[model samples]
Target: MNIYAIIETGGKQLRVESGRFYDIRHFASLKSQNLSSNTKILIYRVLLICNEATISLGQPWLKNAIIKGRILHSHLENKITVYKMNSKKKTRCKFGHRQNSTRFVVDSISLNGKEL
Candidate 1:
């Protein structure tokens, strides 16, 4: 049976599956942990878990539910360009920005100490 879960991290809720890589917002808590490549991360804010036969939902977070992942890297996203122009006054402004993000691969999803 295929298993998947929804987890909250970095102010976003993401639907993830095992053995998949996802790019998410950079986590400030991870910065203090000295995360390197292949570092394991435990996410406790799991909202839902689904299998082919059944589903479990949490009011806010599931007790004893965890999502395991490995950090791959942290990098910036593609540049976004912003431009402002004013007619007659001959004024223009242009800027670009890139958002910082982290890439990780989901290892497993477990509920109540049992792997799904």
Candidate 2:
């Protein structure tokens, strides 16, 4: 099935298609400007048509749309870790890391029980 959809993820909206991967941190997408006026933009992936709906507009989920995808690998992010220790008394500290990422492609987008 193929169709259009507007998926909100990572505090953003994406008009994505199938067989693609996109970075969510960059803000906005290929057709729209970033909602944050102070943020930069990057098109990490391409959105292919996955539905019968026109490329004009649609609901967040394309009105009964099914967007499928795969884990086309993971995003590249800086490794972050922190740790601290104290002597004598007995104290300690620690930290962790996170690899920012975006959403995968819509392997298939279906609307109204139909694939376009």
The prediction achieving the highest lDDT against the true structure is 1
Model 1 poorest ten-residue lDDT run: 26-35
Task: Please provide, for model 1 over 37-57, each residue's C-alpha lDDT reduced to its tens digit, 9 standing for 90 to 100.
Answer: 888899999999997778999
Model 2 CA deviation exceeding 4 Å by range: 1-3, 25-62, 78-99
CA lDDT of each prediction against the hidden true structure: 0.88, 0.49
- Taking all chains together, each candidate's TM-score versus the true structure is 0.91, 0.44
> Per-residue CA lDDT of candidate 2, range 1-116, in tens?
35455666556667776555566643334223224222323232323334355663343233444555543333547778888888886889888887755444446555556655
Clashing residue pairs in candidate 2 are 1-115, 2-50, 2-51, 2-116, 3-50, 3-51, 68-107
- Least accurate stretch of 10 residues (summed lDDT) in model 2? 36-45
Alpha-carbon runs more than 4 Å astray in model 1: none
- What RMSD does each model have against the real structure? 1.6, 12.9
